[model samples]
Target: MTANKIELRSVNVTRYITPLREGGSLPALAEADDDFKYVLKFKGAGHGVKALIAELLGGEIARTLGLKVPELVFARLDEAFGRSEGDEEIQDLLKGSQGLNLALHFLSGALTFDPVVTQVDPTLASKIVWLDAYTTNIDRTVKNTNMLIWHKELWLIDHGATFYFHHAWDNWEKAAMSPFPYVKDHVLLPQAALVEEINDEMIALLPDEKLREITNLIPAEWLSWEGTNTNADAIREVYFQFLVQRRNNANNFVKQIQHARETLV
Candidate 1:
């Protein structure tokens, strides 16, 4: 997690026009800038604070885990667009604040698989499964691969579903325990050589100071303050715990892959 000096840039809302995706609430577009293209979402969709927090924080976590995801930034609009601009209909649909958007790097590659019919590379799938396990990510399934292929490389996106159970932490005592069933069939489970290679690379890249700093990048407005000043610290702690768990589990999974490969050979 080497903290790359991320310069927060204010986006010019009017310069680029985004087309709305079918069944997608936010307006999205492929950008002209090669360094960052794809403004996939804008703020008018009325999802609550918790959902926003999950997206922002989960993006950071994915970066820390050495997963290839699009660069994310907080964006603002000068004014709300009128009914003709798509705001009128969304206004009726959402309850919270409006007039802002979150920009994510637009993935240029093709979707590798439909959640139900496609298969992922074994090593990549294992890493994703390990990450989901640590973060309690509920959304990465056969239905929403959130996985992509570009230039023969795999990329992950749409982490809005991780830590969905976080708010229910107190109910852990009665929590129904079940293992992630899909782990057994994940494509990455069979790629022992690749998993070992990735494990070493990811571990080497994740630096402690960088991880701490990345946590601070999460927007405070996305959190539940409720007059409590500890919100920031608490959120950071949760992120840290997830990182630790992810590292540990990833290490074990890598070993499992290696052992299995050896046995097969």
Candidate 2:
């Protein structure tokens, strides 16, 4: 769906419940509407404006790139919805405390990996690494494991890690090359079975029109666009390059998987 087509709404602060995780930066919860339920992650004062922009724009980019990310929207909370007094201890555990937190609600699903074990298919894992590489996302580590599996498919989440280059655009080239190992070793080496299919799916899913539409949903203030009137071209270029690299990697992986399967047979 296009950004213009998306109906952004403010979430009622009173509706939010206490978070499920502890000592992390944001406050997260499971929330429900009349028909739909989603995980709501609040952007606490610990994170500055950049992180907020990353979450907003990053999810849209992932969708455009054909990755299965949960539907996200910019939601404002009511004035009465500020942090509870009991949250003080949790707040103290966070690193940087800044502006009032905003809430991010994700569609509910099952977690893919446990801290002790990596249970995802290799190709799918690689594709995720590829997607993160394309976006310059730095947080999809083994520790974060922001992937979900449900109904026999994978979905990605927690993308407050992209736009790390926003502070220094020149770092783009370096960031682009860095994620290849993760994509190759962890994602492509093991489960050669689905590399070809996953690659094809990713390539087929990049929607240019959808990307352009969603770009509007990104708040202008957080991007370089605001005072300078510059568009998001720089970041878009990074995303584009990432796609190109992933396609190549996918093809190589497919060939390797085919060779291995043939040998095994």
Once fitted onto the true fold, the runs of candidate 1 whose alpha carbons sit more than 4 angstroms away are: 1-9, 15-27, 30-37, 42-47, 92-100, 108-121, 169-204, 224-230, 245-265
Best by TM-score: 1
Model 2 per-residue lDDT tens digits across residues 1-265: 3334544454443445555563254555635343344455454434455566667667766766656777664444444343453666544422222223334455455766453555566665556555655555666655566666656567777777665765555655455444333333223234445555666666655555544455555554344533444466655555455445544444543454445445542
Total backbone clashes of candidate 2, pairs 3 or more residues apart or in separate chains? 5
Candidate 2 residue-wise lDDT at 137? 67
TM-score of each: 0.66, 0.62
Q: 19-91, model 1: which lDDT tens digit per residue? A: 5553355545634334456554544453444555567667776776767877776655444433345555544
Minimum summed lDDT over a 10-residue window in model 2 is located at: 93-102
- Measured by lDDT, the strongest candidate is 1
Error of 1 at 119 (Å): 6.4
Give the alpha-carbon lDDT of every model: 0.55, 0.53
